[model samples]
Target: MSSKRESPLEVFLNRHDDAAWRETLVTLLPAIHEVDRNAAQVWFHFYPLALLRAFQAAEDPARLAQELLMQGSWYLKDQLDASHTFLYGHRFWPEVKRAVVQLAGGVEIPNGRTLAEVVREVARAAAAERKVDESLTIGIAAVGLMALQQVGSEEFRRAPGEVLIDRRHLKRTPEEVLRERAKDEGQGLFGFLRTADRRWTVVWDENADDRRFKALDKQEVASGAQADKRPWHETDARCTVNEGPIPVQCRSASCGTCWVGVLGGADKLSETEWRERKVMPLFGYVETDDPKPLIRLSCQARAEGPVSVVIPPWNGYFGKYLKRVREGTSEEAVASS
Candidate 1:
């Protein structure tokens, strides 16, 4: 809950309940501020904008540089973690930071930069170096700026933005908003994942990961290993198996069957992904307008680690339905015009 137009701090944060914002601050205090008992309670009173004012107040490049780096570092390890699961297996920071380095490579940028500041720097660097698609690049730079800072400093506080961000750094990606809201509302991850445990032990089938009925059309379960073996669809419908029947439909992205909400083990799951984003609307469950929602189709979504999830029964041709609605609106627009 933030506003589009820049306005006073109170006005920018006008929509969302203060309680949730304060709770997030409270939750992040230990990792971010690392303040004392009295100060922790007062941290929410200090908005990111207020911090920005202080950061900008100091004209010292060395001091500002130190602070900005700390801020960037917090964004990666602490703040972003609030929403997106920072995964392993990536050395791609250079590609993302190409422009940021080429220009600022020599000239010093304020290391105490805020999310907004780092983004602006990326934009400037991109313009200087001639690059497009600076958006994701900026995000990577933010992560990098922080990583570099962590190597040097200890104190860092991230003034995270919720959806409809009022300030710069608090600006959140849709995925982040979903995750934050889910955590705040106790709706599990993106209002789907919850703390849980998988009862039945199952092997990882990358191919099967994207299937509604992993237990179906498979010899592993049907193999004549023993009488106890049964298709998990029948045996695990109640969410009791170590490997449950992943909710699915169309055995394709066409239907969002295999859409399972995480119960206890969200970290065990892999990540919200490209294909998952492509098919989410097809299921009619529009948690967020994000391209990828953490709640994913079991068929399309895979878990790198073990995860426990609750499967939803209801399914609809939501993508088609949304298209129809859009078309109808377009017709209405024509008539009105």
Candidate 2:
């Protein structure tokens, strides 16, 4: 009797389960450039599972990251085109092509290489060099290779045979970065009062030198102090870009508009409260017990100290879309049939 075969989506997902994906990311992170790594990390957090469903139904089985890189602008209509920013920035694609070719034993990859092709090459290299079983899935290997190529190796030693999560790349330890920013801002006559109060720095844009905000001790930064009106609160001017700078509405987590990815200071952020915990999954951003995950609703996260964060270029109500997919009622599923 013949056995049932798993679908491409299932096979891909099973090969790169959450734990394995995270492990691979941690391992290859050192090889990726700091800027690219930061951008990729944020992109990883914002990856939409809804798109995965769409791809599955469309019979187009591709790497989730690659799909995002190629077609995310259409699906995430409200987002600021993060894929274009990262993939095209500083000639990133050429570097990835070079890494893929090197891993393929100097064989020239065809121009316009797809994510699956690059991953297959990396998987072959990893299995041969590491002497690991060939059963390792290409999805996991691809993510690892992509990260490795993006984050080029540091000057110390050869790349590890077995990848491990290295926390050293976390750059500015939250506490230190926040403290220095606060000091640099300088408090005058109220310095004594401010000294008594703990302040944290929220680096909203990792790429921008000036895109940062100060949060007073124990105060939720999302609250938007009267003295400093947040960009989201400015209604007088129209934003020229889609997904304009930390676009937010309703300072509370109720709007799901203030989501962000913690790039450097996950530990320094306030623990996830019940409201945020309940609401985040609803936003389809994250569903985990980790008190301070990379994806967070800015309104819900209060800073204990300094943190570097990346604001996702878009936000929307996709919880219902996911629910419909799970229930087999999604329009994509019906249309595909």
Candidate 3:
């Protein structure tokens, strides 16, 4: 009997099943940003799957980073379908074309090709002229090209340039917005309790509108009610409050369970402790010297002012795993298990 052929998506997924691909994708992610106006929307769809794949890869960071640099735009194709799924459901190239056409004001994209193909073409053009660095620019340029195609080249070059989709046309600056929020909250009989100095807002999950927390100054945002205090892996109950629970355990950064991605207000939080800096890399989450980076240990990250953060869906002792990989004992450990 003849065997069935695997679909392109299946083939891509299978190719990345090895640890190397996943690790490389994860290492490259922080540096990857949206290239065009719709880049954020496109990336948002791909991030979860990309992160999941990275976590599953369980490879050594040193090797992963090197692979990412060498692979360049070729690496992005593996996760293209996943990104498309985020916006167009299970539909693939056909749906992507439709969406692109719709966004382009019904202008048909010449040559039937997927978004990834178009991005690769753009990257190649830039590389030909030596106008862009393949290592640093290709990944984001691909994403930007998707957004550009969706918006159309004509509109992208128009006056004031309709490049990115600006949903928030706020009249106030970030500081002004925060100031107004503080003023609005400090109005009731218990207004003193809600003073700017005493309390602040913690947007625990930027994607979830309801995940915002009204927290006290210098309070440990990860701690929950007595009933909900359980190790994050052991139970779903993290820290419980009136707003809802924020994930936690050990309340000390030892477990690596409460790590979060800081979306805004990095400057507002306390500086990273030596322990956090050392441990975060092992977790394969983030490795940077910036005192306040996008990644933070929620248990250790005390809130002093209003801030927004993105909680990863899962966490673990990936640092230890990475150590094993580096030592060449990871395969042995897996085989033994």
Candidate 4:
């Protein structure tokens, strides 16, 4: 049997690099998360089409998977109904998902629209229908587009209509969640004396009520996981693949497996040093000069106060590959000239 052909929207999504998408998403960051814009930005970095495309194009995917230290599910299609769970706008997923399908199905191929335009159009429509803040729908709309790309137009149209989130998760409103994200517990009165051994809470997953670990003052985020002796690997697939609440291979920054997105309390962490600054871009995770950025290697970041972080589903070394591609393109341009 012949394989199915890709849809125009899928082709469009596949054509752009993470930077292009980031440029658009960053502009709407203030609209996506009321309190945790940085964290949401990090979440976008969690999944990259370029990385997924590289994996798909590899000659030996299994071997490449090993080299990349991939864990959990990278393909958004497999979790289409619930992929936006981590985003605050997850509450609007049902409407957003439906809008994505309707938009892709109704539009003609090569409509001359960028992915950024599509995201805004869907978000604006969903907000108008839901009568909620437009900001609430922005992230979900972006997620819906990603789903459409991963599953293709046909599967997207046929995707399940029901919401996949557990009913229990609906107890808190998005506004309440935003308030919680902005919360910061101060050290007790004795803390001012500097005599108490200060400790802080690190929330690995915000959606979970009890998914947290404690870290001592100035303790590395990954190191605190060592104190949690629970059989985490038995429960979380990511933990199963690697070792801690945050999957880490080289605790010394040799491997990019321990990278995470700080949803809150970025300033509470230690400043980004030279070694981490150099390796993050090489790991293809972050490219910034900020001392403390949203994206960070868990092994290198030390907590000074309570923080919330999101671990990516996969990790890899793709900076060299991207650099080579850029050089090749430059050479072609020179020859053409």
> Residue 132 deviation, candidate 4, in Å?
1.4
Q: Per-residue lDDT for 206-320 in model 4, tens only?
A: 7787788888888999998777767777765556343457777778988887888887788888999899999988888889988989898989999888888877666777665
Q: What's the candidate order when arranged by decreasing TM-score?
A: 4, 2, 3, 1
Please provide, for model 2 over 232-263, each residue's C-alpha lDDT reduced to its tens digit, 9 standing for 90 to 100. Answer: 42531321223234555666787666777765
Give the lDDT ranking, best first.
4, 2, 3, 1
Query: For candidate 3, lDDT tens digit of each residue in 24-113?
Result: 434444543322212232243223333333433645644543432211111223333323221111112332233233333433345444
- TM-score, cand. 4: 0.86
- What is candidate 1's local distance difference test score? 0.34
Q: Model 1: per-residue lDDT, tens digit, 1-337? A: 1123322222212222334444443443333211121122221221222223223334453464353322112123344222121211012233324533333334334344334454446444543444433433333343333332321112222322222222432343434433432332233444335324212222222112232222211122211112232365463353223333443334455544445444233453445565566666544444345433335555554433333343333333334433443465523234545
Q: After superposition, how far is residue 121 of candidate 3 from its true place, in Å?
A: 6.7
- By lDDT, who's the top model here? 4
Candidate 4 lDDT score at position 319: 68
Candidate 4 or 3, higher lDDT: 4
After TM-score superposition, what is the CA distance of residue 139 in candidate 2 from its true location, in Å? 14
Give Cα distance to truth, residue 16, candidate 4, Å: 3.1
lDDT winner between candidates 2 and 4: 4
